[model samples]
Target: MLRIGSGAGFSGDRLEPAVELAEKGKLDYLVLECLAERTIALAQKRKKSDAAMGYDPLLEKRIRSLLPVLKQNNVRLITNMGAANPLGGAKKIIEIADELGLHVKVAAVTGDDVLPYILKKCDSLEFKPRLSENVSILSANAYMGASTIVPAIETGADVIITGRVADPSLFLAPMIHHFGWSTSDYELMGKGTVIGHLLECGGQLTGGFFADPGKKDVGGLAHLGFPLAEVQPDGSALLTKLPGTGGALTLRTVKEQLLYEVMDPSSYITPDVIADFTTVSLREDGNDRIVVTGGSGKERPSELKVSIGYDAGFLGEGEITYAGENAVGRAELAGAVIQERLQDCYEELTVDYIGITSAHRGSFSYEGIPYEVRLRVAGKTYEREKAKRIGEEVEALYTNGPAGGGGARKYLNEVIGIVSAMVPMDIVEAELQVMEVKPNGA
Candidate 1:
């Protein structure tokens, strides 16, 4: 059996859980599934500024913290924390490993950037909003597959980093590398894909996202542990977490995670295969352990999905807290004042009294008057100056608009929106570049 642990679920996840996995989990591979749909687009923007700054900002810290333990425990790491710059990330890893005098092999799998391919066929794309001349494209990346990382594994790399690979591919790659699972083996492919889907969100499987006050109570949330999967050659997995770690790994959390972000339960599509999640079966094996099986897959898709990032505009936001006597009224009145003054500044405005009605936008109200309320105003505009006004107007509330209003803050940010297009599998190529430290020393 092969043991794989998830270190992080998203780009900004906490670091300690990953370190815990490395030092204590006793695993074959630990994957930091940090990249998200919008994450790489932002990384691309950062890359345009500093070539070496595009990868995960925490890449250095993570690699530094994990190197000694991972090397000592002989646990390999596979992660998409490379974001927009896998080669840069790999180089950074080598530098860190050398500083610690640890000998290890690192490989970067690249070629997910498909900007040129998209630009060549933009006019002919079947998707809507077809490459408008006015739209400024920031980044275009094709989601890579598990097969891409297999070559890196074959090179005996201790750490493998990649950019724009699918989340499941990070976990699935190690499986493919260890089990010798052929890409054409649909049954095993489907089974392994489900394992990735379940464990990709590190803490969710361990009850971080499943906690409720009393309804679905999870114990010891303060030190919630990440999850790991034990896989057999038959493609079945036993999912669990470390002992004495806070958080429950139960069937409830597993079911919720299984259905998370899955629109079509039977037809979950990925670069490597089209897995049928509906075919999956889950059974409780013991406390904090579940046996998963029955996931099946069809052949791969003809076209790989591409995430297209384009400059949307600037988003400006401001917030102020209102307390005591008719706080909701004061908050509403303050929002009205900003609304009347800035009608023509932005295309649209979102005004919310956060504690009272942010969720439904005042469509429904919670019970009883709250003692305190917060007024928030946000809008997006094509002009940065206009966007800046959103924060300015809210800051003005401190002196001009409402009584008892305090703790005002404002922010202005660049906004990048993501759209989807399709690229054929043949057009995108995945290659591995290896950087190694010798067995004797760096």
Candidate 2:
């Protein structure tokens, strides 16, 4: 059985769980699935500023913490933490290895950035009026498949980092490399995809997202363990986590994860194959173990989905807290005062009595007077300066409108909007650059 573990589910996932699995779970491969559409766009923005800053900000910390454990445990690392710059991420890894006086082989997979390709070939693109006429296209990256990573695995790399690869492909590539499964073998590919999908969102398969204090009361949440899969060559696998660790891997946890973000159960599209989740079978095998089998795939898609990010605009926000008697009234007045002040600048502004109606947005009034409340004001505009006015207005509320206003805070950022485009698979290529670091500094 080949053991694979998931270190992270998203860009900001906790790093300690991954270290736990590498040191104690006896995993053969550990995959960190970072990089979402918005995060990548943000990374691209950072890259535009510093060229080398596009990769995951946590890459260095995660690597420094896990490298020794992984090296000692003989566990290989695979991650998409490269974000927009796989090469830069690889360089950082080599530098870390050299600093630690360890021997390591690292591979950086590339060619997923399809911004230039889409611009030159496709015109009236998927997102708007016209690709050239509207929207500043910040990034365009195709979802690469397992085949892209197979070469890196073959190079005996201790750590493999990639950009814009499909989440499932990160896990599937190791299955293909170890089991010698053919990329064209749709049946095995589909089955393996199932394993990858389940473990992609690390803690979700554990108790991180499953815990409901009363309804689904789960144990060991304080230090929730990440997921791992013990696979057979035929693609059947047992999903579980490190023993004595936080969280349970029961049938409920497995089932909840099965349909998470899945639109059509039978036709889940990925870069590698068209998987059908309808045929999947799951059963509880003792405690903290779910045996998963079935779920097959047909041929891969002719076209790949590319996530295109645009400069949506700038968002400005500010908040002030009001507490004690008639706090709700004071907070409401503060919001109203800001609204009237900005009435000429905007037709409508997002002014919320946070504790009163921030979530439901004026739906379901507070039955009883709240002892404390917060007033929040926000607005979005194309111009950055206009956005600043939102926070400026909220700050003035302390002395101008609301009494007992304290702990005021404000924020502003360039909002990123994501849209999808379909590009021919032939247009994008996945390239690999492998490097080595030894104590000798070679």
Candidate 3:
């Protein structure tokens, strides 16, 4: 039986917490997923000169803290925290292991950086690019399937490092490698992959954001529970938490997690197969252990969906409240005034009243009327100066409009600007490249 634990790792602190949980849980495999296209871009900026291996130095520091525990428990781990450079990450891991006198094999999965291959393939196929005006002829990486990770496992690597494999595939690879499960066994491997999905978010399954709404003052949520998976040969898996851990595992908790990111209730696609979520069943087996049974799989799609984020322009929003007779009507007029003021400076500014009960008042309002109203104004601009200017205008309207009679007040405004990209579907398969290091003779 193989038990896999997973954690999301965009930041060092986010994933570092998992090490303690893994050690305490006595898990067989721990997987950390940390790549989104934006994550790659951030890694790129940090390592601008090298253009390949610049990851958050916090990752190295975090890993160094876990090395002793990992060696002590003989617990193997896999992580895509390598960012854009697997070898660079691997070199660091090996050096740390050597210094600590831990004899662990580290394998770097390469060729998974198929940004070049994807761009070349786009020339042959008329891929409909839906994201940006700039032609993304480069750096479009597909969320590669678990197959590429097998070579890293075969290399006797105690720890496998990767780049852009799908988040769930990080956990699935270890199961496939350990069980010698074939890719053709879609039903089985799909089950294992789904197991990874359950654990990916760390505390979601463990009553973090969700719990029985009726249950008050629950036990020991200060530490919370981590996801645990029980796997067998047939690919049927049971989900649970560590023994004596703090959380509940009713059918509702498990089902809530299963549907977390699912866009369609029926067709949930992964690189390996189209998982049919509608057919999934859950049963309570024991304390904190839920049996996930049923649900078969179909063949995977021809293309992969890549998530890319790039440079968008800039945006800001501010809010104010008004309380008095005809508050709702007065708030609408104030909003219109704010929009007209913003139009003078920004061509694309917009405003809306968000929280007032009367925003939805006309729909069915034979009932009691609202005593007060809240209004919000939002603006988007290509230039930061214009965005700030529009923000000041909206706040000025609060104390100077018809609603100004209601003693309106304004709060601080928010502003932001960043380069974002939404990467199209592409593939980054891993190829094993090895070199024999000269031995230090005794």
Candidate 4:
């Protein structure tokens, strides 16, 4: 059985502990996914200016700590934290591994950082904006497949680094090479793809963010444990965790991960899967162990997927607390008062009394009276500098108006507005396809 661990958010520094856990548990593969909407923006900015400087410190630091364990255990990793500088990132990792006298082979799966290329392609393709759309492509990342990483593993690398790839590909890459799973084998591909989906979110199945629906104690979420998947030759996988780990690995957790983002189970497309989610079954086999099997996958669609970000515009928000016998009522009045004062300053303004609302779990539920309330105001302005200046003025209202016993004023910080525009899927498609060439030295 090949043991694997996966996670949602990955930072260079946060990856250190997870690496230790993988080594301590003697797992086969460690996968970290760090790409998010904001991450994409940061990557795009870096790529345009200094391509090499965009390397995330989190990826390098984590790999540095894990290298010794990986060298000892012969563990191979696939991570997408290589935002826009996988090659530069890989070189840094190689330097660290060499200094430690560890013979680590590091290969970077490139060609996925295609923001510049995609924009040029869009100009020639005559792509149009559909929904009052504007092309502010803040970040452009390619959602590649397992083919990119497979070549890296074949280089005998202890760890493989990659740019943005489909989340499931992280789990699928190791399974394909480990079990000699063929690409065209739809039935087995489905099996492998499903396994990746189960373990990709690390602690989701291991009781971190998600827990059993009906069970309260199931959220034993003090120190969230990472998730693991054990794969077999037939593409079936055993979903479990490190020994003595604290979390519930039941059908509920597995089902939650399975049904996640799955609009249609039958048409689930992975490079390996030709079957549907309906073809699979899961059962609680043992303590913190769930066995999953049976799935078929279909061929992937033609258009290569792209994660492109554009300008979203600017926004500003401010908050203040109100405390009194009738805090809820006072808070509402304060919200109205703040809006009235700011109406002449901003073109758009929104105010909400959070304490009495669903926010904070309705904690201040009072019988016709309450202790405290949170007043919040949010809006957008074409001038970000002006918006920030406006956010600074809100706290003054507390001392000037009926702000509930004039509780100490709380001012919100300057808010910077970022506009994210979604380009057409084709707007970010690859122009120069990635061809896997054999390593020069290996």
Best by lDDT: 2
Name the weakest run of 10 consecutive residues (lDDT summed) in model 3.
413-422
As a TM-score, model 3 comes out at: 0.77
- Provide the TM-score for each candidate, comma-separated: 0.97, 0.95, 0.77, 0.84
* Candidate 4 runs further than 4 Å off: 7-17, 47-50, 121-135, 211-214, 269-275, 344-347, 358-370, 404-442
- Comparing candidate 2 with candidate 4, which one achieves the higher TM-score? 2
- Residue pairs in clash, model 2: none
Worst lDDT run of 10 residues, candidate 2, spans 124-133
lDDT of each: 0.90, 0.91, 0.66, 0.66
- For 23-132, candidate 1 gives per-residue lDDT tens digits of 88889999999898888999998999999878998898888888999999999999998889999999999988887888979999999999888878777876544555
Evaluated against the true structure, the overall lDDT of model 2 is: 0.91
Q: How close is candidate 1 to the true structure, as a TM-score?
A: 0.97
Candidate 4 C-alpha error for residue 183, in Å:
1.4
- Candidate 2 local lDDT, 254-355, one digit each (tens): 999988999998988999999999999998889899999999999999999998888978999999999999888888888888888888785457888877
* Winner of 1 and 4 under lDDT: 1
lDDT of 3 by residue, 34-94 (tens): 6655666556445557754555455577668776777678777788877767778877777
In Å, residue 138's CA in model 4 sits off its true spot by: 2.7
